[model samples]
Target: MVNLINQLSMPLVEVALVLQKHITALMTTLQEHLDAAQQSANANVVKPWPLDVEAAESSTNFPVEKVMKVVDSQRMDILETLIRVTLIEIDASIIEGLLALRSWEHLVRTQLALAKGPGQLFSPLDIPEDW
Candidate 1:
């Protein structure tokens, strides 16, 4: 592996580096989105009280109706944003993984060709399942 990396041309090495950076960034962004989703979900606490208006009015323990209404509104907005962001992040991560896989595959093919003649390269062989 060291020899392969050392033998790679500048352009190929740059390609590998770019792919690594993209994968790292995509993973970090995905983690941030997951954290944002958790924070949004935890931002609101739901408390239920007896439905009787007299009891609800008499108790100051329960949240005020106005406050509950505002909280609900914010919760809806957060939920919408979370869903959109999560979907976008998931798509980006999948694409990044695929890109990295493709890049490595190409690099392996190039390295193999350099190590052995093209005619001797990539022969199909069956391996025993048990090593």
Candidate 2:
């Protein structure tokens, strides 16, 4: 029974040692990855938009001016088209609301006409004076 327990415990000890080694290696790898990520983050810090523009301008090899002009032109065209579409949608909504109002007015006028003859305007409701 003692030998059998020793055999089982020896394998368990070996497995524990192997697991510890793997854990240590994993920790070291994770630390190395963390350091690399930190270094990369420091190296690749993002500049502000104005600084980015300045950098682009300073890099004279690229045609930044022409690209900007084209982009601006396209942007203006898109804005104009969007504005026209929005105006058309707004006009359609206004027309729809006006049509609905006109329909409601017609219904109200018809009801009022049916309620009274041509020159009489008021409706009398008979109510009891008691609370």
Q: Which candidate is the best by lDDT?
A: 1
Kindly state the number of residue pairs that clash in model 1: 0
Per-candidate local distance difference test: 0.37, 0.32
- Model 1 has an lDDT value of 0.37
Q: Write the per-residue lDDT of candidate 1 for residues 17-72, one digit (tens) a residue.
A: 33344445544665577678874212111111112222111212333453334333
TM-score of each: 0.26, 0.21
> Which portions of model 1 show Cα errors greater than 4 Å?
1-10, 38-131
Model 2 score (lDDT): 0.32
Counting clashing residue pairs in each candidate, in order, gives 0, 0
* lDDT (C-alpha) at residue 33 in model 1: 70
Off by over 4 Å in 2: 1-10, 39-131
Give a tens-digit lDDT track for model 2, residues 1-131: 12322333322222222323333443455457667888422211111111211111122243445434433334334433443354356674433323432332333333333432322212221112341
